[model samples]
Every structure is written in structure tokens, then in C-alpha cells.
Target chain A: MNDRIYMDNCVTSAMAPEVLEAMKPYFGEEFWYPGSFVSTGEASSAAFEGFREVIADALNAAPQEITFTSGGTIANNIALKGLALAHSGEGRHIICSTVDYPDLLTHAAYFEKMGFEVTYLEPDELGFVSAQKLKDAIRDDTILFMSTMVNHVVGTIQPIGEYSQVLAAANHKIWFHVDAGQAFGKLHLDVKALGMDTLSVSAHKIHGPQGIGALYVKKGSRLGAYIHGIKRFEGVQPGGLSLAAMAGFAKAVEIVYKDLDGSIKQLRELSDYLLEQLESQIEYVELNGPRGEGRACHNINVSLDFIEGEAITIMLDMHKITVATGSACASQGLKPSYVLLAMGKNQVQAHGSMKFTLSRYNTKEQIDFTVAKLKEIAAILRERSPLYNAIKKKQEK
Target chain B: MQYSEKVLQHFMHPQNVGEMENPDATATEGSPACGDQVTMYLKVDKENLIIEDVSFLSYGCASNIATASIITEMAKGKSLEEAKKITWRDAMEALDGLPPVKAHCSVLAADTLQTAISNYEIAHGLKEVPDFSKETIIGELKKIIYPQVGEDIITLKMVKYVGFEEKTGEVLIDLNLMSFDQYRDNVAEEIREHLQKYPEVKDIKINFPS
Candidate 1:
């Protein structure tokens, strides 16, 4: 009936037209790889350096510190494994939270299998892992710690500054790595200010093209090579990366960093409006994450009582809207969202949770239409819900 | 895995979906904790032993709702004996096919319908309440789908052995699932939920291949 309304920007976003325009030339005649002497190669090398500078500038790091990777997952692998391999001789203990992103958790599992001990810090009910907990979990043999800057599921922004302070107080060096795939453009990140030894960010999360991301390894940190294939450019991740995609990533970074404050403000307003509308229009809706500034600007997660999230997601899809749900039925593994469960939410709450991640493209009108359609869907589904009927009967009694 | 066009049609616009007032017989299957629960209501023609009307209320995913809707449609005009023959496979065939992971929804819908029919027959003095025993435990196990293959564990031979200690109300099951099987946890959780409803099963221990 209408153009597809995409609200799942946290997974991937619509590439900006400007980024495509910037990438076109690289895909065409300027596609030469970086070289030592050839004119075309030198020019390509200079352009590559310039693109790296754009991303480094956003993070207040040098161009040489940035290593381009295929995506956030690869970047995470390189930084995390590199840190582990380089420092495992020093200590075989790692620390992370139970509610961290899957990338970090999987890496933790791998480390555990490699004869390293891992301590998972528990998060508060609102999904915040306190720095005090991190300090307490630290041991004499703890050598590394990894955290997700902005939680992908609930959008809880962890206390990175306090975490860095705690790690600094440790007697032994504890390398800190951050998975900032969801935080890159949404928040102002200064690698030096955050005191993270290594960090990862993806281009697609900020209106850039997919299949391109960057890893920031703070200067003076020795990371063992994770990917060893070729000597194409100097970086931990070896092999040739797409010049066109890097150009697009640079363009996307420039656009967002150009007015980062303004973009964040707009997203916050849109999400606030959406949450407000849902609360006012719907009955028995509960917010899953923290309210106000503690949560990310783009994410709004809420649980609708008496209705399963998969049904709601499909009904909204029929209305030409796209969103995410935490229901076990929607998952390939047939398990509820681990993030919500880790936050002490019951299975029903997790099953009914709906996630709406806004972007620069969303508007007030779109939010209005979505909330209205969602209200109708909730009412329709509730009419056919035994849970709701049972409640009504109980109240009648 | 995607739903068939028929399944989507039924899910988007399910038939006979509502709360039935003054139903002759009713049964609810599954649980809210499992993320799916279905309640079925039936009005039977006592003289003719035919199902005069049928309705259902579902709290679950699209497939769960669609299966319940189609099961009600299939049972509406059938005799009690005829309705008793309707299995989850019939519902799956009626809806073209369902994803393997969602095949359990059909089982839940069919199970609810059969239970409603049993309730009616018992109330009408046509049959006695079945005794809960080892056979009853095995019958419930037959309803637990493997999810990955869209087949029950009993049919797939995943159930290595089933033991019941009637005096202690303890049930033991040895499964052939490997320790690394992705569906290992799902199948075990399903078994517990299915058997926990029976008063005879006070405890369950599921053994997997280490």
C-alpha cells in the first residue's frame, strides 16, 4: 500500500545517496590498489589514506591506527583474537558481562575452550553493568576485558569511562576492547578519552554501505596478527579490502560527524515521540530498557502484554512496516532473547517484546501511522487471546 | 523458513477465532511460558454425535494461530469419530506445509482439538477417564516434535529409552541427541513441559550423549 517503512536500522540501514555518489568513482577508473611508485597506485594509496583519516578523525585517532575490515564481526575477531594471542602468555583470564553482544560472548566461549578462564559480570535490571562489578571481577591473572558500547537488543549504554578507570587502577595491564557497532555514529566516541585499547565499528550502522568496517587499535598496543594472507596495506587484517566500500564508509562518516549532535537530537525526539504514542494509545504496554538519556536515541523496546511478538511483527509486516521481535518463535534457535532474560525478565515479557530502531529517515508522520496500526493490531490480537480473556474473567469475578 | 501462502492467509485472517460462551466442551493446550497456548471450544450435536460448531483462541506466533484456525475449520462438521482421526499431519497438509521449526504448532492445535473431544465424550458417559501410566507418558512423548525435522521424537528414534517409576513419580528418558546438537536444549525443554502437566510425573531426568 505504501513504501516499505524500515525501522530495523540497528541490523543494517539504507545507504545514503551521497555515499553511493562518493563510491562510484572508486568502482570505476580509480580502482587501482595502493602501490609504492606507479602513479595510479600512488593516487589510490593517497585516497585510501584520506578515507582512513576521515574515520580516525571521528575517533580522535591517527590514520595509521585504523584497519579496514569486511564488517564489524571481522573487526571484532581481529582485535579480540589479536589481543588474546599477544597477551595470553601474560594472563589467561578474561572478563566480560553476561549481557554483552554475541560477538564478544562467542569470543569468550572460544577463549574458555582455549584453557582461559572467563568471568561474566552480571548486569543490573536496567541492563547496566556497574564498574564496581568489573573491579570486583578483576583478578591477578585477568588480562583482557571486552564490552559492547551500546547493547544491540536493549540499547543500554554501558559505563565505558568508569570501566576504563577501573581497568587503569588494576596492578597488571588489562587490555580493553569495545564492540561499538551500534554506537559509532550514534554517540561521540574518542578512543583516547574512552581509554579502550581496541574498538570496532561498522559502516552500515551509520547509513554507509554494507561489507565495510574499521578497527581502532590504539597506538603502542601490540596486537598479534589475526588474519595473515597478504601484505596489501599495513593492518592487522590482511588481504585487499574494497576501495569503493571504504570510500562510501568515509563519506558516511563525514556526513554524520558533520552534525553528530544534531543527528542524535533528531533521533532522540523521534524515538521519544514513538514511545509516548505507544504508551498513550496502547493498553498494558511496558518499556523494557531504561527511559530517558540512559538508553540509545534510536532504540525503543517495549513489551505488549497478552500478545506474542512474532504475531505483531508479521501483522506489521503486512502493513509494509519492518521491525524486530525478541520472541522465541521468531528466532531460528527457538530461544527467547538472551539479553532480556539476562535482565531478569520473564519468558512472557521476552516473548512479547518488540524492538523499533529509528533512523534519520523516520518522521513524525511515519511514527503516527505505525502507532495507529499497532494499536489496531494489538486490539485485534487481544480479542483472540486466551490470556486476555482469562484476565477479563478474573476481573469480572 | 517461510510460511506457505495458505498458512499466511489463515494467519492473517483466521477463521472461527474468538472466545466461545457456554461451550459444550473446552480444552487448553500448551502454556504461556512456552510462548504458545491454544484454547479450543466445541458444540456437539448429542443425537447425531456430530460437531455442530468449533472455535479457538490462540496466544502464539502466526503459525500457531493459523494451525488452530485450520483445525477448527476441519472439525466443524465432522462426527466425533471422524474428528478423532484428525492429526497434526492432516493440519500441516491442509495448510500446504509449515516450516520444520513451526511444525509443533500443528501438533498443539491437533492435541487441543483431540482433548476437547475427549472431554465431551467423558462428560456424555461415552468413555471413562484414561488411566495415567507409562503408556500415557509415551503418548505425550509422541507429541513432542524434533523441530529440526518436523517429526516427533518417537518417530525419529531420538528417544533411546523411557522409564517410569510409578511409586516415586519419577520419569527417565535417554535421548540420542549429541551434546553439540543445536536442538538438544529445545527437545529437552519440550519433554519437561509436555510431561510436567501430568500428575503422575513428579520429576524428569533427560540423559543426552555426552
Candidate 2:
């Protein structure tokens, strides 16, 4: 139905057709080094910097403050490791949510290796880490605080603005970084508006080309470069940016937010329809993330009892529908999701977790097909589960 | 997960997916907490000591389901001795190949099969059943003493269960140890050496529950 339903947008979205068209000239006709002083090089650099201006304008920051990164993970690494190294003399303590993007948590481990202390804050039952928790965690030696604006697994929108306000009122000399990779295009993210000193966004998550992202490092923030190179990225990342990818990123940003209100409404309608159908038709299925406000408008995560998520994904994949499971089977570690565990879910419930992220291109028909297929698969799996049989026997008695 | 073609084929159409009502022996292994478990049901031939019918109900990834399906097919119509010898490697070979990480799924399936047979031996009390009682085994184990506990093994209550088959004289004792692991081998050897003197005890197995 409708050219193979794709519900894995949080993994990566399809490059927008308009973005591809905008990037064509940069790849073929204007394919010169952006660093040269010749006419062609000047033309290419001007076009590349013009896209950078689009990013700066969207985030309400100066052009110099925006640094083009390889992608979300690299952007996150630069923020966490970069700040940790630069501010080591000032302090050695850092704080972040346990359910933050893996790149952020991994860097926190690296910080620990370097003798820096890290505190991982657990989120509420609905996966919301409030500003009060962030406030209570601040210490005198706290050098940096980083958290994702929207969780990648559950899509629970954190209170980035209020958390930044708490840090501001405390007036502590801690650097604040927001991993806005999942929230930048969907949510109206302005670095100044959110009172955040630094933030990072990945372009591929919003229908832009892969391998391109941007990090807004506010003026006067001290950050040391981990990647040693000469003169490129002001020696921060020390590499050249892909001119075509940046052009596609800018064009995708424009296409997605062209009618921002309309696109958001569409996302909400599709998301709500899926949740409603699953709740009405399925038994023993529970939503893993929040429902209305504070939850992402285009994402839904659910956990079905007496079943496994990897089986569900594979069954759906056989039906030409794509989705993602957060089960240990889906992970390389062969253990349940640490994110779901941090959210207070037991291992069995966490093993049954599945995430569906809608895009601007998804439709109601696709969700209906997915929900219908899920009902059949869940029933079959439950029938074959000994735990399910025992529970049914007990209930019957 | 880079699953083998054989795994996908079996998972798509699992054989004997449900359980039997009051089968000869049924055992559940693994847990939902670990995301891999299977409960095997066996109907053994009372006269011949062969597994006549077998089925499984599992909760795990594709490998778990596929391994259960294949192991049950391999175990059915085979002697209890042959079935007990099926290893995780056999399950993987039967599956053609499995992802290296998912090798545990094969292990879980084979372990569950052995568990079902043990449960059969425990549940069945035939006319040919041995006269050995739980107290008799405990009395025999009392001959061995652990240095750390400074007492006979029975007083420590580490021996949780004892099952003996009359026809084969097979004895199984489950141990729940409270001491460190380094001394376990020595303690086990002393018990095995003591039990060996009884010619009626044809086979003996010492198992510790993790």
C-alpha cells in the first residue's frame, strides 16, 4: 500500500525531492574546492556559506557561531568531549540524562576515563526529566550539563527551555549543551530563544542528506578541539564540509518548515490516529512514551505484553512495512534497552518495546495497515508464549 | 541480524508451537528477564525409553523460535540417551548456521531439552523404579564433609533435590551452594568418590543452579 510504508524516520528520513534538486548544481557544475581563491572556488565558497547563513538565521545565531559537523554523533562528541577538555582546569563534573543519545552517554564514559565525574539523571515514568531534577543535580564543580531536547527512543520532549532557565538563574559557570538532533526541524528550535549556550542538529533526520549536521556553539564558549588539523572548521573539527550535502541540508530545512503549522498538524493527526487504533483494537498493549503535550507529535512507542519486539519488526518487515524495536534482540549487546530500564520498565516489558516515527510523507492508510498487521502478529506470538498461557489459565480459574 | 536462511525458514512456519496437557515431562528454562526462554513438553515411551512426541512454547528472538522448532524435530522419535547428547553445536548445525551472538539461543534450546528429560525421570515412578529414597541418598552424601562448613553435606541443606531411576540406577542431585566456587570441585569429587562404592548407583550427576 502506497509504495512500502516507512515508519523508521527517526532512523533516517528520505532525502526530500526538492533538496536533491537544490544540490544537483553543487555536485556537478559547481564542483570546485570551496577553499581556492580562483573564480570557481569563490563561487563555490559563496554558495556554501550562503547555506550556512540559512542555518544561522533559523537558529537565531551569528554565522560564525554555527559549525558544520559530520553528523549528530560527531556534533555531540565535539560538544561533550570538547567542553570537558577545555574546561578541565575550571571543573571536572558533568551531568546528563541516562536516556540521552548514545553518543552523549558514550562520551560521558570517556570523560570518566579522563578522571571527570559524571552524573546520569533518570527520567520520570513517562520519560520526562524535569528542570527541578537538573537543578538539584548541580554541584559547585559542575563544568557542563547536556541533555537531548527529544529522546530518540521514546520521543519524549524534554523541557530544554525551562532547564536552561534553571541553569541561568543558578548563575553557575557550567556550559549547557542540547542534543537537538531529533527536535531541530520539527520543533521551532532557536538557540537564543531556548537560552542554550550550545546545541547540535543532524540533517538526515529531517529529509536532508546524510553525513551533514550543524552545531551552534555560542560566542565565548570555551571548547578544545579533539580532532587535530590545520585551519579547517577554525581547527575545531579540522576537515572540509561537503558543499552539496550542506546545500541539500538547507533546502530540506526550507521544505520541511515551509508551512510549519500545517506540517505539525499533519504529523499530530497521523500520530494520534495510530495511537487510537492500537488502543482500541489491541489488548495488553501500552504506550511507552507520553501521549499529548510534552510528547513528540510524530512519534509513538508501544510495548505489548507476552510478545517480543524483534519478532514483530521482522514480521512487519516481511509485510513490506518498516519499523524499529528497542529490544535487546535488536541491540548488539543482547540485553534489554537501558533507556526503557531507566524509565522504570521491567526487562520483559522492555523486551517488547517498539518505536514508530512518522514523517511528513507518512499517511493514515499506512498506519492503518501497520496496526492491522500488528494485531494479527501479537495474537499469534501470545498464543505460542508459555507465560501468556499460564497467565490465561490463572485468569480463567 | 544476518540470520541464516534455515533459521528464517523455520521461524516463518514453526512446527509444534503449542504445549501438551499433562505431558510425561515438561520443563521451562531461561526467563523473560533475559529475553530468551523455552518450555519443552515430552511424551516418552514408557517401555522403550524413547521420546515419542515433543513440542515447545518459547518467548525470544527469531533464533530462539527457530532453534526450538529444529531441536524438537531432532529429539522426537530418538532415545532419551541420544536426546540428552544433543548439544548447542548440533542445534546450530541443524540450523545450517546462526549469528555468533545468537549461539546462546541454541544452547538454551538444548538445555531445555535435557531439562524436560530430567523432569520425566523425576516425575515417573515405575514398577521397575529403584527403591532409593531421598533420605537414603542424603545418608550416603553424609559420608562426605566440607571443610568450610565443618559438617556433613546434608546438614548444610545444599542438596535441594534427589531423583533416582530404578531401571537405569541414574541419580541426580541439585545443589544450592552457599560457599565460594574454588572449593566446589573438591567437595564434588569427595561426594562422587563416596557414591561410587554403591554398585546400585549406575550413573550420577551433580548440578548447581545458577
What are the TM values for chain B, all candidates?
A: 0.98, 0.60
Model 1: per-residue Cα lDDT over A356-379, one tens digit each: 999999999999999999999999
In model 2, what lDDT does residue A181 have? 86
Model 2 chain B, poorest ten-residue lDDT window?
B143-152
Residue B197's lDDT within candidate 1 is 87
* Candidate with maximal lDDT: 1
**Which interface RMSD does candidate 2 score?**
6.0
Q: TM-scores for all candidates?
A: 0.98, 0.85
Q: Categorize the docking of model 1.
A: high
Cα deviation of A91, candidate 1, in Å: 1.7
Per-candidate interface DockQ score:
0.91, 0.30
A-chain TM-score per prediction? 0.99, 0.96
When summed lDDT is taken over every stretch of 10 residues in candidate 1 chain A, the lowest stretch is A231-240
Best candidate, TM-score: 1
Root mean square deviation (Cα) for candidate 2: 9.3
Query: Cα deviation in Å at residue A348, candidate 2?
Result: 1.0
Interface DockQ of candidate 2: 0.30
> Model 1 off-target regions past 4 Å?
none
